[model samples]
Target: MGLQHTAFMEEEVRRGLDPKLARRFLALVWAQRGLVTLSVVLLFLFRLCAVATPYITKLAVDRYMNRPDLPVGDRLSGIQWLAVLTLAVLTVKIFTHYFETVVTQVVGQRIMHDLRLRVFNHLQTLSLSYFSRNPVGRLMTRVTSDIQALNEMFSSGIVALLGDLFMLGGVIAVMFSLDWRLTLATFAIVPLLLGASQVFRTLQRQVHRVSRAKIARLNAYLSENLAGMKIVQLFRREAENRRRFEGYGLDLYRTHMKANLYASVFFPFVDVMRAAGVALVVWYGGGRVVQEHISLGTLIVFISYIDLFFSPLRELAEKYNVLLSAMAAAEKIFGVLDEKAEVLDPERPEPLPDIRGGVEFRSVTFAYEPGLDVLHDISFTVRPGEMIALVGATGSGKTSIINLLCRFWDVRLGQVLVDGTDVRRVTQRDLRRRIAIVLQDVFLFTGTVADNIAMGNREKPRASIEGAARAVHADAFIRALPGAYDAHVSERGSTFSAGQRQLVSFARAMAADPRIIILDEATSNIDTETELLIQDAMRTLLAGRTSIVIAHRLSTIKRADRILVLHHGRLVEQGTHAELLAAKGMYARLHELQFEDEAGARGIVQAGEPSDRA
Candidate 1:
């Protein structure tokens, strides 16, 4: 047990020493280091005054008791001196305590501010893949609760712990000076107190760990439930969800109870040891006083110093738990800071100027993972102002092609060139800015309709935004709304229908006036009426620009200058729709399948023709 506890403490200390986060944490506190030092100095000065008060008290007691018959003038003088010292100490102590509180609060808030901003900025830089895997609740807990725990460590724990250490050292020094033998006897309980504290700290840390884990789980459950409330109601799964939530809630409650139980025991145990220390001090000091080894006044001074000494011991015990909690919080925060960015810009990247959007894929074979190619030895070229349609079934690498084009992920086996320069050679920001994409899943931020449309060009005038919306036929519906362009969109534009959001997305893309446009299943989720509107918008959006359209519907690709039929990550056919139909290949089969479905809906079947097999 002892070995295990030691190892745990060592691990916690090691995690707390992460150099990057440690530097950040130190920088936060370092800004106020001068003020903190002044606060400490003032606190120590107050302790000095406090220490002298007991001596003054001893002198007054000795004078009044042993020298009662002294001259009235001398007694009055002594009493006045003691009163003056008492008042001075009281005044200094009060102001110093106030100063310490103010300084600690300022330092704590500054550190928290820096930490929150740093964490939020780092989170923004992290890849989308990280967010896809981690729960929102867990991330929020790290940002909020974890940082709060560290705040406690800084605002109260560190200051109190330091002051206690100073008081302990001062008391021991004074006690030994007064009477070393009795002082030694009074400190006999030190080892026992230390041992008990270490044991309780270990237990408290374990309890805290369990409690934190349970809380994270509970938070995850709450977030998931809230986000999927509509789905739960639609499927009538409220009872099941309630049961699951109760289980998580109960687990969190039990863990919190256990932690509180451990804390409850820890303080009382320390209090018992404190009581023992006080009893030892009085017993040993009484014997010394009886033997004339120490004067009554001196004994009283020793007792006062002992009381001051134990105050820090008690404080140290209380803050041990906070220290452990801070270490845990720091470990989790540093874990994020330590994660290396998987995709980074090159050290010396060349800039591309006046790009003409002539894209070429030279033997490009790519995969998300090693030894598994999703696009194998694929080669293609798209000249400026060309429209290319990629027609394929589900999981046929169409989206992967778009992902590579946008440089969301780089090709592994070969090079992708834009305007005779390798995409990897140019800055990612410059490459992405030149391209605009309208995806099947249209996302709208919480803002006015005009604002959403103008997202691509925030500096664009309201006239340009309205022009884009009009070109996409979205202006009619938008103007019909309560506030027209100024109407606010709810979260994800839940107020708008799916087709309306897609049209707004189209307008957003059009507003950018990008050199290249990508439509990846952009019209798949829209109705026929909306699709017609988007088609008209696409004609204008794609004019004088390179375009790539990934579509499943055969009707959408009929007008493409060239259609590339992909199968199993390989391009099977490439030609105009008419030319492919004449060839009677995969494109022809898919076309027949779609045409037959239309004919079947019309209650018509051609004689002597086999049913479409796509």
Candidate 2:
């Protein structure tokens, strides 16, 4: 996501699973305690049925088969009854397994749903700075793959571990009851098994940690590359990009191979241990049975119990990998949940009802980074219904001023007031609702033209949408499109021309009926014809509303009520367009330079017309 997020992830991998993180994760699951408890109960029932199967077979052999003193009919009857009981046990085991799988999976999915929504909601509350530092793809991984990992743990890893432990416990108890000597023989191999498992876990955890990081980086790279594919093609970077992608893919491949290598050696070692345990049972228990110390049935049961015991051990080793992966995912998810929003509403916010659109910035000094101010002691005021234009060189804090007024970033020093009430004193939602911003780069979601104009405010009636469109001169072109206003908009309004998108953006701002309008380089991308249309529409659109327009083009803001020229984050000049020009200050110089550039551009075009005729 960011350097900080990446560092934290690496630290978590090095530190391994934190019990505190696991507890926090469990707390989320505990919110659905009813379903979780039911799933656990079903698991236990399944285990009980599974354990009974071997014992029923033992009972048939020990009680019925060895009783030769009984009549044939009685013996046959007993055998038949025991067979039916075994079938019944098998039936119950199958049903219990079915129900348990269904319940556990449902719980897993419900938890995923809740967690996904929780993460999404938290994302909404985070400040814009957080998003600036994090990429969309990395954050998406947190919501999608990471949450899926936790779901896998719930469905298979954690639940399976519990079930396996329960099975192992039941098997041990039954084995010891039949013959302590044979049970002790099986116990001898467990220490070796445990040692092997410890080694495997350590190795696998590191692999899993690295593996997760690799996948996340791969996703981020893929996302970034795909988003910029047009540039890549224009630059002919196809070969270079493919090589880089191959490198990422190979890195992931090596990680998986390393994990597989470890598993290959470890699992076979576990099987050898199981075989050794089985061999021990046969050797020691067979002699005991021959000496009449235990029945043949008891010896067979010991062997069956031995298999059951080792089965869990093997399963536990496998589930441990899933557990480690889930732990890492949980840590990352909780990290996001724990991030406090840099901008927050005061516990008791001042009410800002019926805002009258007057804005004031009182000696506002701000910095995106400490000790590096972007805006230095900036002070300005806009009376209601006044249209002021901000003109400056790039990075002279023109857009930063807009950001402060909108409270996108809080001022480090002094107050930004809306209608003389400190903007910070009111909730951001309340303050922002009174302002509408139309930026240079307008972002439109994938939806219909009408939807983009409404911008998720579904309460706007069809008449208002159309009226706003017509007011911004967007209605004419929109009605000419394939489905008219109902035509589909591709991602980021790529389907529309640059001018069309800008017009739609203006319409959107107008549809909001905001008290204050912000047009930051809003007309810079429009052609001359479209610009004239917008300028004509803006006279009517901006009437009786406080508007702040920031543009690089001098001609666009020539008629502003007043012009403020900024130079290196300071207010160098402010006055009516003619007044600034008469004073011969920074505004005059900028205006002259732009006029010369336009003349030079016209000369070049006129010069090229003769070559075309030739």
Candidate 3:
């Protein structure tokens, strides 16, 4: 049947990635093994050049720049050679970084694409029940925002963390080699650094988790508001909604603030510790240099190594945030992925091929939720090419029957059979292809009028599309619009009137050319004149097909081959309109009520409800 296309994807993006999903993300990273390996090589090469620069400077200072004892000409050539070597090393650093950025970013972007596709595909496979429970905004968040967190992590997190560790290791090795005593003194502040880092880590995790959930809430709220913006304005809810949104915004703000607060406290803490380490090195190494235990060049290199060592450690901390965020996002993405669609094709599906439409519900039972049956022990049979009408009070399971007929849901007990084959035995795709349903609420996509008429059957020729519209009597009005059949339909076909949209929906169903046609209050929006035009066209439309109609109109129901009256969830009566009136049950009472209701508005003796439907 039809479902509304909502604008409720008005979502707020949060920076979130998953800690639990990290290993799986690593597998994604590892999937691009070649790129990852290249990045590693480049990172190491970059760090090597970085560490070598100071050592080269030290060599130049001790052996060439400081050695005035050599011939003046020789010293000048030596200095020039050292300067050229330093420049070459600097040039290499630039290229290494350039290549590293390109590879890392490409791999990161690819991973993000794959992740979004995975989540979207998973969502597609999920049952309608799953969608009924989850908000569109939340799914939109996972695909758009949560996955974006992984992109940040891929571009910066894991790679940076590894590279920094490698750099830290190299610097530590170089420092210890230069002077063990000085290296030991420099490491005195490391324990304090670790403690502060641990504290920040805890704070960051809590902040990320809270931010993830709060941002999801914000997105859901915003989506709901935007979709209902008309209602909000009509009811003067702007001030109240704004206040509610402000509360959500404040929660999000506090979440970010907590993350930033820890980050703010962390950097200064790290900077202080770095300075302490540098000071320790300067005091200890300077004494050694003064006593002639170590050369001034070695002392200088040791201090340079200290800065190199601490810089990467600081980088790793920032990278940790990205890692945590990515992990959180991955966790959310995987949560959706891990859930299997409750409704799926059977392993050995029976074929539903080239058949006349005859539907039978044999002792069928169903429900939207467990233990609360919406349809109970419902048994009915429609002959091939029969036009059956279902009249019911609210919650009488008419729509549920249509849902079952289409295999939108399986029967909980007994069987719903199409041409004597159990509906559950066939693939849903195949079964639905044989049924065309037009509901009260029609959803029109953005496309040309002809394209909207064709719907997903994109290969349908212009002639076929035009023919479908003509068959539904939609062609005349469609031709009146700008550019006629080629005219563009705005989002949800908003440019068209409700009656026009319904006509297009009729055209779409007509184009499908199914054996079974279901119209659930399909003529509700049409003006009486247009409804008459549709009713005339529908006779031809239903000439060979089995039609199941749920409408309040006496004109529509009176023509049905048989009318089934329902009360609560039971099929309480079944006969023709004349027969049902002769029986004088719920059908007669409803008929009388609808006659009075339409009399006040249309000044016609037609039976139809103005404000309610079963």
Give lDDT for model 2: 0.82
lDDT against the true structure, each candidate: 0.75, 0.82, 0.80
- Model 3 collision count: 11
Q: What would the TM-scores of all predictions be? A: 0.85, 0.93, 0.92
Model 2 pairs in collision: none
Tens-digit lDDT string for candidate 2 (149-188)? 9999889987778899999889888988988888898799
Ordering by TM-score: 2, 3, 1
CA RMSD, predictions in order: 5.8, 5.0, 4.3
The segments of candidate 2 whose C-alpha lies over 4 angstroms from its true place after superposition are 1-14, 522-529, 599-614
Per-residue lDDT of model 1, residues 194-229, tens digit only: 887778776677766655555666676677778778
Candidate 3's TM-score reads 0.92
User: Which pairs clash inside model 1?
Assistant: none
lDDT of 3 by residue, 33-63 (tens): 8988998899888988998898887887778
| Candidate achieving higher TM-score, 1 or 3 | 3
